[model samples]
Target: MFAARFHPPMASAPPLCRRGVPSDRPAAKDPDAPNPL
Candidate 1:
């Protein structure tokens, strides 16, 4: 349930998320990360 919201952003940047970008870590949890897309 909690992951639904985060899914969108993560889906948008799966590469970054998969790469485990430390900076993008927060972005995976929230949409506050600098959207490179």
Candidate 2:
């Protein structure tokens, strides 16, 4: 049961990381412009 609980969540993690939509922070298009975060 303990292994079952941990394994499923870890398996799903890779897809989330690949999506690259981390947090609400915005990506910068230009270095001179202010950070959108």
In terms of lDDT, the best-performing candidate is 1
RMSD of each: 12.8, 5.1
Q: Local distance difference test, per candidate? A: 0.71, 0.65
| Tens-place lDDT digits, model 1, residues 1-37 | 8799888877879776666786667667566454543
For model 2, state the Cα shift of residue 3 in Å.
Answer: 0.8
Please provide TM-scores, in order, for all candidate models, with all chains considered together.
Answer: 0.28, 0.47
Off by over 4 Å in 1: 15-37
Clashes of each: 0, 0
- lDDT tens string, model 2, 1-37? 9999999999899977766664323443443256453
Count of backbone collisions in candidate 2: 0
